[model samples]
Target: MLPEGNEMYRSTYEAKKAFKAMGSGYTKIHACVNNCILYRKEYTDMVACATCGKSRWKVVEQKNKIYNNIPAKCLWYLPIITRFKRLFQSKTTAKDLTWHATERMVDVGVLSHPADSPAWAAINDKYPDFASELRNLRLGISANGVDVNRGNRSHSVWPVLTVIYNLPPWLCMKRKFIMLSLLISGTPGNDIDVLLAPLIDDLQLLFDFGVETYNAYAQEHFKLHVVVLWTINDYPALGTLSGCPYSGFQGCAVCGEDTHCINSLNRISRVMMVIEDFYHMITRSEDKRSKEIIVDELDKLQEELCVTLCLLDKHFPPSVFDVMIHLTVHLTREVKLCGPIFFRWMYPFERYMKVIKGNVRNKNRPEECIAEKNVAEETIEFFSQFLKRVDNVDIPPNNHNNCGIHKGVDSSSITDGTPISAAKLVEVSAELFSKAHFFVLQNTSEVLPYIKRHMEFLEHIHPTKQNAHLEQEHSRERELGACRETITETMRWISHGPNKNIIKYDVYAINGYTFRTKAREGKVYQNSGVSVVATDTHISKEVVTYAKNTYYGVLQEIWVLDYHFKRIPIFMCDWVDNRKGVKRDKFGYTLVELKRLGHKGDPFILASQAQQVFYVTDPLDQKMSIVFKTPPKNYKDTYEDVDEEFSTIVPHNDNILPRVDTLDLQKENDYFRNDCHEGKGQNLSTSLCGE
Candidate 1:
């Protein structure tokens, strides 16, 4: 199919050969049918398994099948040391390998990366020799079984992967840095340890005896060392990997002999204390004194957890107590030893598993298919690094990449959305258009002075008019550019307002968030919850009537206005009525009634001024839902002489805990009272109560 002058591979064999030559190769080790042992070292020459007495060759049918002595199963093992050397061969990656030690912002109270955690510090304290070299690597391993064919539950593949913690937080979790160490096919059962023999041997070697490797960045040969810090997996997989009982009376790995259980329940169970809250409480950006106070109180916190668990064990049924419940006790200790659980978790590994599963083209030979495709991808990625001004095939641009203020830039440069069509266009009504124009002007820093002048003139002309009326007259006058005082070129055009032919969008991405209209909320993910902190001020009788409040709303429409030189995006939202539509639960979660829409007159906000939030439906009331603020992803906030005002969006851990009224808690410790109402109650006087 290729042209006569084209230089391309003619067949799959040629392409495979080129890829193998360019990339680090994988080893195919044979295994017994019953998952007894791997055919390596001592077992290499054996015809059958020594333990299970199972044949290593495939059992073939006499009529049609050929009697080739092919191994029943094979484990694809990728050597780690060669991949490590390859990472150092690239100057960009070599410099990034030491970022944990060199470029990390060492804030004592903050946990941005695993390097900021106490576990990393503990390693440094124990091994001064290893810690002396900044280039040394700390790694985390994770393994999980994924079914290649959804139809067949019996056929599974287990992939052992490792993440290099030496890289910065932004780069470490990325798919490029996560390496596939081993691929075990079929049911390994309890013999997973046997399958992991080769990888473990290499790890043991790297730990005890370092390898001499060339650093392309430093341009010198140096001894490289590594340490496997921890393992990330789910409960059952954790048991499979660690050889610990994840279920039953003695399933609590950390508790050991002190594990609490009840015999009444057929299966072992225990209460899971609120462990997430405890961890989130201490994972804040606090001062040295505050951090010290939290650290010193760890024992006290553990004691409180023990007491809470005891209380739960007494009240809750035996069935409510499971292995997951008992695991909560060890979380605080893990926090102290391993830092925040968010840094080292199975979520990223599970996400990467999907990428691995996508490479499987041939179901008959899934292992070989995955290995070959991964090698090809790695080869392509390596070559792309050297090519200038070319997009990497494997690494796509992040959705949250171009976030924050893009001031003085056109909409086409900053905004990403579908191309506007005449069919999707909706003309803005004069009333709504004026309101949206004034709102954009009110929020603009350059137009603030003009607003103050315009408001003062309105108050002077209509002394007897109410603040609300004067504001309405100001909006009407501004649309016609009829202000008594002269304004700047920017303000004049802004006041004159945008084109009436407004373009509508169902979805739009800006300011590090992807926003969808309420019409599109039928989809799986809801991205329509819009919020903005609005300040309303009225100048009357020298009394500045200022009210600042956060308005929660459902995004109804997205409209972009054309001002000839620039296009500004605005969202028309259905704001919930704060008086009747919104209330705070006992846990301080802002719950809103989506059915009760309000704020009809003022419905527009600048896309940049809005912060994304979501609503989780309350189990007790179907009409109400708890509000959750969405944090910006992959955002770097240096805050060093930045021109735009940087709004510090809440960090990942800060919003994990529900706000509670301490006074109410002190009065009554009804932790699990079914009768207690979550809704806020009105203050009633003693006389009114008596009446």
Candidate 2:
């Protein structure tokens, strides 16, 4: 019965002869087939199997044949051998085909490898068409399969024959049918009826046939067929229903329906419109009050609508998934819009109001607080439901949290209950309006008027309040004064006059207890000149002394002698013994005491070196005298030269006399005139000071 001219048939005979010649003890053979070459080794000696009358051979010569040279009669065997190899290799190598085959095989066992069941054999006998068209069968071979080199064989006849005989006709037929079904069902179209009609009919037929077959073979499995049919039909119904309104409806007036249902429909439509409007309001508008109303309405609608839809799901057996999907998408859009709208319309003002209100009202109203807490909890529950619906639809993770809207609300409440306040909320709302109004302020200067208006509004509400909390405000005012003084002093030094001409320096000296004068036209009299007095409160000497003592090195080192000379005494005053108990003889003329007396008598002396000399009226004599020598022709003597000459004739030995080498009083006067014409603390003074 062996095929004629077959190389394997010839090789089998050759192997037997070789074994017999070598005498009987051979037990096994190793064979390798590669690229039309068959390499074989046979055991030449004989052995007996205890369980049966079979004989084994061992230790014969190795044999090889290049399949290309083998007789043409051997070709018939190649396909059979190749088919068996493909079946073995497909298990590891081809996933798509294997998955398709394996899934089907779970219901119907492997077609190529039959089991011991008579039912399977009878089915095989009835369908004798085992071989598939070569084009339809995809072959795969892998190193993981039996006989790794088998794939190298050009024409494996035995495997091809075995596959042709063993292949199941039912599997191939079922595969073809499924592929055809998928092709017909997957066409694209907006009209669901047209797209799905053919698929539904085919699915129905398949359902009936499958049900019949399962009932005959295994009655219990017929229900699974019905379930599969229902699942496939679900998607089609969804598409059809979604497109119905588009195809069947006309204008509302023409589609005459019952007034009650029609009214309900109109209300639902209005809810949708309001939802959409809220989206635009939060995202696009800048009006705070309008946005607030929209947000509140949106919250109410979300709660009512979502609960309504969930209840509808219980009544209708159709896919609620699509409706939930639409609702969730809308909710997600709202959540995303909440943050920017809140920040623009509500957050800042709310935060400011909360700060202004201080928590005093809430402290005594625990019941009201608890009620508000319940509202917040309800809000969180609404958000949770929205999130759950979104999750069921398998929305991408990136869109899940709507960029942290829920987290933002929760954090704002938990960390600081409603961080937004009324004033800041108004400010932010106004900013948003401004942004919407000009968007690109072409003139740019127009922005100034808007800012001025807003600032004026803030002033009206939080106005300076007469500095009623003056002590608390003092440190801020002091810092501001120091900064103004620095700028004025800088301008004075850069100009040609004494710093007294700088209005800020004069004001500072007057406030610091280092300057004094009778008022004329609300200005301090000094050197035949009028200087503006500082409006800032006088800093206490005791506090100043404490500051100097506490931060001695820091304060002393940075106290600019040319600008802030008043700050220097806070450090030096420790050496001044004005106490009556101290012996006047031991301290000599008491320069420290004299210095303190000078500060007390003429605070204007702190303004400039010239002012100090011009206004040092002795308290005892009631007369003013210059201690240093008179100015040179140009008043350009070096500091050391003037100091040496001035030291030769001391006026009062232990008196705190002015140094002769100090800046020329006339030049300093000229500097102040050039620097302080606008006066200090006025808005125009900033221009004079350059900053």
Candidate 3:
């Protein structure tokens, strides 16, 4: 405040004036209070609305007052062309705007982004001119009602947002990149089309003649064309935007005239296919089939869905056939028409709505509050682009942007350093040290040949012993004494095992996951839970059984064992008892009893082997919790590193749906109640029915 040569404005009026000079202001167009028409175009000079005959200005008492001019309602519209031009004007975003065309990996059966989907290819094939310019934009529109009053009163402010598919998959849906096109106050209902007219007109203009925009990266100007690829919304908003009936007999938009439903008082019928199988086919990001195969599968799924719906009609009442149930028939078609559901869904927009709602400081004028805050943030973010050594304050920096692990080298691994003073060192017992050392050696690629030679020597000596017994023998220190001299220097040190004194940490980071011990977990989000899937072998006298089993545990300590040459991190966890303490619910969620801990003797696992997970307490029982797995923040499911032989960590695929062909639904034998005994009326009713 004391500095005189600063560029900062002194007052809100001065700041607004400077921001306005930058051409980032919202244009306010008055609307009829009755939601009849907007006071624009031919109605610009009118004093009253043409359709409703209502005064455009708000009525006020004039008793020697200033009589400030005010509109009853107004729509804050941010012009689309200027925002698109600003994207290309920035060197950073200008290069990123063409990432889909230049940097995206093109694979036959993998789909990680919207551009990898069939819909993008179809657009390229049909509109060759639009595809000719890699900088041309493909957009997705999303709208939702943001509760402005925070449930204190009945008020909603709807913001129509547009997402650019030109940016990379990681940045396209981020809050800073999403453009807020229009903000309408109150309930628009069916009149949303009227409010969307201005934005639609601009889109049409952009598509017809295109806009001349400067590309900062190319150092030239090009005509930029735009197209709306799809819309993201929930079921109710879907009906509002598409003008489709979301209920009753004509609930489905894709099925059209052939919608299926049942009348009231229905009994039951056999379901044709499993609903879980249908869910598995649509949400898959990896292991996708070819276009021809997908079309054929969609055709089969459509037929199966029709029969399933008819069977559902027989079993359940008409109320059960809501819009969501009916929308399943259209899902396969939507995947064919518009990529995967994850790319074009309302989840990201719903999350962004929280940020939008947080800007409402003034409850009385929420629209104005949001508009001013948005423009301020936008101006700051744009200014950050031209400055050096400055981060865009509006966007949070990714803390989990980890690089890939190179073969046999651990330097590329990232971790938040331990405390300088509290770098506690603890000495574990002989059994604990051996288990941790053996796990690190078993998982490391450099120790594979030495392990193979040791296993072969064990097989030659113990011919009658089972492989499981030999494996257990391999983990012991006495068995490794015979071959310690023949192994390499790294393997020799690993075979001898780490010293009893090792450095211990309360927190450690690996595989893009931040882990904390149970005693150290005091934050809002829990990070103590962990899981790993490994092969379990059972050996009998005549046969052997091998099955992949998942183990869940709570992290108790983080131990980094120093092998002189390299430091290997391992976690000491209290593993939950799999047989009695763990079970899967009907909805496929893993529930574990945290109190029922087991496997105390064998508690250490390599840090690289852990797939980070968190436990949400089950509402039904406080002792139980539902497990939710987490993925890395910047992890993209692409084939960009397909040729790499070994990676420190692999993406978890435990949730991938299994390939299933058919499932049969069983029907009950008796439909009527034969035995009923409650009070005197129940027996009388049973006698009268004579079942």
Candidate 4:
């Protein structure tokens, strides 16, 4: 209840509810009419925008500008601290908030998770103190601008979102789980760090002095430590956030990994600079001199990053010379290791942005609309924890999908790939039933025993050698069209060429296994012998690794033969490699990308022996990456020596980075630059940061 002196809100039920539902952590700060800093805290007393010298407040006849009322613009921040606290309130989700600590498999040099990557390990080693808190919260800060104005180009809205990595994957990208933490109002601008100053300040405080909060489930209070694992964005946003060239000859956020493109003949002549073999120094020999050389070469790659920055064409904006490529990576170093590039990326947020845009009806005040929607969504999500659902999964379940574990073994499991309810193996759903029956037959030796048990169960119901009625439709069709009209007797036993038997029936009236919450996929066909693994299934047999290598199979049995009692699970897969020979099921074939993931088209893997392949099954996931080896001698370096004044003169397609950079940026125009530079549109008219 509010005090009697309070005039803004009354002590009433509606008012109290409104106050409770309100997202008021945001600070209303004034900004320059011309794109500049959002005047706040230290700049609160300042009368004008620091860069443009424009008055911070609007002149009005109604009343003198009050900090509480409408200022020049509003930067709505739903305090991250508050959001972090709420993450632990829900009993169901509270357990997931510490997944990174509880379940991240590490130490074996596997790139399966960010927690296992080299980047994560280094960060922990670097900051033992911060890493000491087993429950320290981790996050992926993702931001991108979306055209919320239908398809209008002139106006745009960029919402800065943060995903709590502490929570498991299912909730990480869900609209209800994401935090609409900061809303940078108006059309896109390059001054991100300026807008992010407040958020960063709060983050700094959270890092230094963690908030003390009681975990309702744990029943004890502990300091809630947090760290922004990494920032996620596309190339242009990465450039804007890091303050570096993201296109042109100099455009590469990772310093040396920029994809080089040749300038068209009509454009400026492009110069492709060759790089020296830093590898030779690091690997050619292991002597003291070679080690020092390796260190020097490493230093050169990191050299101010200015050498690479200086190589950009002069026509490029001065910001192109700022070599602060991927500055957000410093967080990785502090934490030890961040893992692969895609892990802490904005793809999830970019997708979730659709939900943010869907919430907007009136585009006039986009930030306000997003704020209201985010709070409401979060509240609904919090309450939904107390309810039950028959549909989509509410928890992250992965224990049901490894080795030969399927229905009958663990019948409660359900996978996404499989249908939800128990599909009975019958004539109408014949293909589905056949697939399952074959999986049980081909993968496991227990198929016969199970079929025997099944037959015994069936004899109790009705003793008969006929699902003869099931073949009636087929016989009728042949009689209607065929000249000879031969009535072939169907072998009712589990039929596989010459494999049908009297006791082992082909059609088992059984429930198709449900693995709705399993890994890789859900819903096993009867026995879950149908495992769709990647083409590289030969290497690691893990169907979950790469989609292209995936093919459905009946995982038959686990065999431990010669390799000193090693358990090996083998599959009788339907290979996409060859349909000409003994290949059984031909839905699709192997897809292989030399350097990419998605298929270019059908017949992805161009194997010459594709048609000759006969054996389709093998030990699954048996060939996963088990060794880290050095490159062969044939590995060549693309390089040449560089001078201080050397400029990489190359004309490239301007299709990159939605916006380009300018010298002044004082005039509001379409240009995007990296956020690594210290000043506005940094100008390096004379020198390129002293490389």
Candidate 5:
């Protein structure tokens, strides 16, 4: 039968007994108060309270009424009894009686023996007088008569009272037996509600303690965050705190109000601490339960960390451009190495520059007239100075030399007698420097002799021959020919006698020929003056066309002359004379037959033909026209035979023109007629040929 304490236990025990008495082989009974208990006919089957030896019949009705009235009361000591019963049944031996007694008193309405009720008697017998004396013990008395003060002298006794009052009446009944067992066996607080109450309170206390601890931790850990917020809230406090030893632990000096500096540090520390704790906890856990607890703690810590970071961001102001730059450098190198964090740190600087650029574009703002420009200039200067320091750095061998010009001294020149000149040194340095450095120097250096030399070399090596030829040709036609013609025409016009009126000779083109004559004034032509000018109008189109044609003609002649003079034959053959002759027979007779058959009639004619054949020469008529001829043997016979011919012909041409009357009149008439048809006869034959 089951052990009895509370109503549930009593009912369960009675049911077990009834079951046993009925001769049912199924004597195993499961009790709601305790756990399942096994009973054999050979073992004891009666139900009795282990605490007071109260019979199950006496307590059963009271236990049922208590169980019906308060179900939670049944649960108070039921677990303890159930655990003990299960133990006894499993072992089939007498279990520790302390657990059973504790369950019984806590379950049923029972109290400890009189000796254990010292505080009870004081409360029951002394009443108001004892309560007044207890209040004088310096313990703070609550309105409900409970001592709330932890420092009270009677504080130790308070727990006993609390246990009794808090437990159900059924549970109090077994208190003496439970206390005895507890003293002997060292089992404490076997009542389920009593044990669980303090644990639940402690859990709440731990939570509160954690909060306080976190606040203190935040003060130390998030100093930067706190300082930055303080600075932003009370700007003057920044200067006051500036003297503090922990001042450097605050925001950036340049952009002090901005929180990026401190936030970066806080985030880094938090993430690192969390990761470290996670690893420590997981590694140190002894079992799955402990590991799970640790994991849960870590999860909570992570959530707290996230909340902290978010709060830091919300409270802290953004950094300025200058501050961002400093923050990025400091945070990346010293605080945090996260890529996203670095980018966030740099974004402010980029945005600031963009804003500055926009402000510069706004013309209405006179105050910012040069502000944007000045800032840009300063930024450039700053970068330039920074680059100077970077350039001075001696790069490691493995590092790429990005300097445009290598600044390192030439080892090759060290072996030479003379030290390399600065100019040559720069040149040599340029070869070793990186492309980035080279271009940077190229832009910055005002007098870069190396660059000048490089440009010169490029020009010299790749000269434009075709363009040079074109320029030369243009110079001869425009400057030389035009100037010479203008000067000569002016001189000629001046040499001629002037009239009373000042003459103006306007040189112009009539068709394709250049003409110079006096300008008409009041129906009279002027002389002794000439003016020359270039015009784009079609009035001078013919002259330009003629000039162009003449230029091209001269160019062609030069080419032809060069070709002919430079040409040579590959081979030559010896001269040979024709020696073969054939005799022709006249209709009269053959020569050999004529000798044999010489007749007197044809003898006179034949004899005369033979005698006067030498004198029978035809009369030759000769006419001479002016022709150029070179002196014999004056021309040299070389590979370029025609070159010699050109030299001969050119020099002789001055005297080769026809003398008036001897010129072929018919030929001149034909030329004049052709020129007339071409509308040039009047101008050419009359003015030039003196027709």
Candidate 6:
């Protein structure tokens, strides 16, 4: 039999080689199995590891006809210069690189993007040479060891993922955009530092001498400036990445101030360390004196961390510090940069783990399967971006269209102009439709007229036949659409008048869900700066939903159409920015900050409103409260213990008396006496004894 790397497979292999040649090539620097120096340049000829004295090859035989295994681990590097230019290959993604400076921060009331910070501007100021060119690129890096088995089984597959912060929010999460710069794999217990040396070396070179690359966004070439902003990971991953003992005593990454408790890692463990986050500490609305006091303390703590991370302190050593901690303090130097802890946090990566997990088809070789899937998806995505209908292709949904959100392409007819409510009613059933119309019970006289006009306008724009054949086809489409998925909003209806019986009408689900059938009741004034009560949030609990402590907000808009074929009392409420409001027990619902809610778009919510009156004391001292339904919950030791006798599963003999029945005469004589029980003399004797 022939060996696997034979000449017959060369043609196929060459094609793959050609394809990979187009991509960034990696440098495979072989290192000793032990923590020895890399075998490169002059050291490449050495047969044994200089530091560890280990053989360079598994087999001593130098000359071989076919196959041989090298006794060394390889450290790989994907060229930064090649990877940087990849961001601009697509025109859509290329333009998004400038979004940080352009569309991010125009209003003074809001600042959400990192570029809006003083740190970004400071970096620009310090590097006047680089900042002279507005096309300078900034990068954020995150690294973690992903177990190929999706937590089902353990396998070493540490992949370092790097993201470009310059991209917009929509494009940032893409697998194609996220570069797999390095892949670290070894036998059981390999110090990550040994693997990271190559990457660190490259990073240093990239920083010292910026890579010269073409800016496709701009017509000319420029020095592509870059910096490793942060390394994001979970607590345990941080411990591994930072070389900090976060799980043990003196473990908190932020403070590193040990509580010295013997029992931790459970029961109010050290893991939940209270870190008055730098951003939170600075943003709080406090007095000047208080602010100064906080700033003074934070400054001291920051310096302590810096000193500790540098291993300059007498107590600390290089072994205790890792690259993550040293780079973390860099954020403290400039306020514009999100704190080191926050910038490269693992939230996005954690979410992306699901995407990676989904790509795995073969459990035996999950890494290979995921690599193939990721490449295929990225390749398809790259080609799809070049064509039109990018939205459908970019966020490639499931093969089946069962998405809770409407599946139809967004159109002006679905939700176009703001609908005006009618003041009075007028008969319009006769004017708009023939006797064959399906619209029954118009909300009001004026509402009917508006509906009629809207229907006429809709028919003029999207004309449809009233014939039985077309009506059947339309009915079939509506049936399939409704049955396939739950339609939340009526405005986004694909077909007007589902069938012949209820159609020839005007407004579809245009009006929001409401129980009230009358036009007067449907007149919900929803516009900018209108006060309203809202009880809709991601964290809303059944207990809090029952409480009348609904958030007060300015009205955004209220759709007049019925929602989901039911008149639900639903309307959109814009969040009001009020500092004077009292803080109620949210029961875990975090208060939505005005700036965080949305910077440009005024945050609004569509919720079902109820007449839940919350009576309060006035100057006159009046008192009243609305009826509320008690939330259902498990009786978790909250209920009083029942009496011991009744608590048992089987009924107690003392509590339950013996059951008895009245005896009846069976003979035609119709008299029951002791003498009649001759056959059972014991019963007769017992009866006589009783008498």
RMSD of each: 8.7, 41.6, 9.1, 18.3, 55.2, 26.1
lDDT tens per residue, model 2, 153-195: 3211111000111123222212111111111111223432332
Best by lDDT: 3
2 or 6: which has the higher lDDT? 6
TM-score of decoy 2: 0.14
User: Per-residue CA lDDT of candidate 3, range 280-362, in tens?
Assistant: 55564223221112344454555555555544445565555555665676676677666666667788899889988888897
Worst 10 residues of 3 by lDDT: 643-652
Name the best candidate (by TM-score): 1
Superposed by TM-score, candidate 6 places the C-alpha of residue 654 at a distance from the truth, in angstroms, of 57
* TM-score of every model versus the real structure: 0.78, 0.14, 0.75, 0.50, 0.11, 0.49
**Model 3 TM-score relative to the real fold:** 0.75
lDDT of 3: 0.72
Instruction: State the lDDT of candidate 6 residue by residue for 1-691, as single tens digits.
Output: 6887765436846644643554534566676767466777667888788888876665445654322355446555555556566556766566788877665534332233455555566777887786665555666667665656634767656666777766554455555567666655443133667667766766776667766666566666666666665666666667777777765545556545422223322332122111223333333211122111122333443443432322222233323333233334434433334522234557667656666567668776565555655544545555676687565333544311112222222222222222233212223343232211222223223234444554455456556544343333332331222232533344333124322221111111221211122123333531122223433322222122222234433333333233224322123334434443323222311132322222113232222222211122232322211112111111111112222211111211211111111332224223332232212434321221111
Candidate 4, residue 560: the lDDT equals 12
lDDT values of the candidates?
A: 0.71, 0.25, 0.72, 0.44, 0.23, 0.43
Model 4 clashing-pair count: 62
Q: Provide the lowest-lDDT 10-residue window in model 5.
A: 550-559
lDDT of 5: 0.23
| Candidate 6 regions with alpha-carbon error over 4 angstroms | 1-15, 24-29, 38-47, 56-67, 70-72, 106-111, 149-153, 187-190, 244-250, 253-343, 357-377, 390-412, 416-691
**lDDT score, candidate 4:** 0.44
**Comparison by lDDT, 4 against 6, better one:** 4
Global lDDT of model 1: 0.71
